[model samples]
Target: MTELLNLFIVFAKIGVCTFGGGYAMVPILERELAEKRGWAESTELLDWYAISQAMPGIIAVNVATFFGCKRRGVIGGIVATLGMVFPSFVIILAIAAVLNNFADVPQVKSAFAGIRACVVVMIITTVLRLWKTSVADRPAIAIFVPIFALSAFTGVPLALLIVASGVAGVAIGAVRQGRGK
Candidate 1:
């Protein structure tokens, strides 16, 4: 009971404070879940983040579900997910009510522009932090380079790339195991 309440409050705070969606929430998630509460280790959180990105639905929601389940099972997952999404739901509803009125205001427009810039920075920071943790070994680098190139230059879909990478990883692991045997 107590754990569920804590999960709800923490995720609600995250959802309320973060303005730029999932990427913007990453730093806050890391700080609260890893550093402040010690709910998860930094490396584990990074791993969860990576997996969340690859999974269906929003990254933030998926991460919250993962953490919640880890901490308090299926009920916890529900509580955490609701907590993370509730704020956005309320905020969007409120915004919808007054957005038309505020849309033409120059000050509001300028503030939005500033927020967008900050969002970009937050996303870049998340990318750099993830890269440091994810691209450590030779096999990861080997897989990352070509996939990155293909995605950057060609029009390869991210889902397809991730699938291909998974296949490659499995094959490489099999080969290594065979050699050791």
Candidate 2:
């Protein structure tokens, strides 16, 4: 189908453009899916991000599958996943083939250093963009602070933190309903 081909091309573009990983893909995903394509809204993309993180795969691939499945069906999911992966597969292969020769070159080293810095900026942009929507109130702040602290400072597992945050949100919502305020 024409739609399927479009989906594949779009995902392939995303795959080629994203650099630092899933977190780094947030801005690009937001722009492409929400701003340009209208396939999903920003909040919906955030939901997909959360759900994908809890699932058993790379976040970008899982998110692509989610988008594809939503757009078409199971087959779309498969196509989108392949589209999202194929570019990275080829790029990594190429990089590996030449890394030994170029790894020590000053220009290559400087370029990688620059990329790492940009990746950090991109990640920060994602956090800032999501911050207003995610930590909007006192209860959210209450949940976020401790979770963030544990994540940054402790050896506590990430899955446990995610679970703890979910539980906290549920409990907070239930208590708020009980008080009727």
Candidate 3:
């Protein structure tokens, strides 16, 4: 019971504070789960994020579920997911009700503009942090550069790109292993 409450509190805190969505949550997750609580390592958190991205759902929820299950099994996953989602759900509902009434308010418009700018900055920070780990070597760059260009420039689906990247990673690993042996 205590463990469940703690998990709920921790995830609720993260979910409530997180803005700009999943990538922006990465640093906060690292701080709370890895550095503060010792619940997970940085690498493990990264792995969760990667896997969560590949899965067909919201990345933040997926990460919460993964970590919750890792810590306390299936029920924990449910608790954590609810913790992460509940605050957002309530907030969004309240905002929807209010924003509809104040759609033309200058203060609201300015506030949203400011938030969008902050979101952009947060995303850039996330990209830089992810780059250090993801594009560490030549092969990583090889895989990253082309797909990045294609994703940015063309009409290719992100899921397809993710699959292609995974395949390339596997093929690279296998080839490296074969060479070593």
Structural similarity to truth (TM-score) of each candidate: 0.82, 0.87, 0.83
Q: Candidate 3 vs. truth: CA RMSD?
A: 2.4
Write model 2 residue lDDT over 81-161, tens digit each, in one string: 998998989877988987657578999889888988987887788778878887889998998889879979999977777
Clashes of 3: 0
Q: Whole-model lDDT, candidate 3? A: 0.86
The C-alpha lDDT values of all candidates are 0.83, 0.85, 0.86
Residue 61 miss distance in model 1 (angstroms):
1.9
Best by lDDT: 3
The regions of model 2 sitting more than 4 angstroms off are 96-102
Higher-scoring candidate on lDDT, 1 or 2: 2
Per-model C-alpha RMSD: 2.5, 2.1, 2.4
In angstroms, give how far residue 9 of model 2 lies from its true place: 1.6
The digit string of per-residue lDDT tens for model 3 on 149-168 reads 99889999777888788899
Distance (Å) between predicted and true CA of 8, model 1?
0.8
Q: List the residue pairs that clash in candidate 3.
A: none
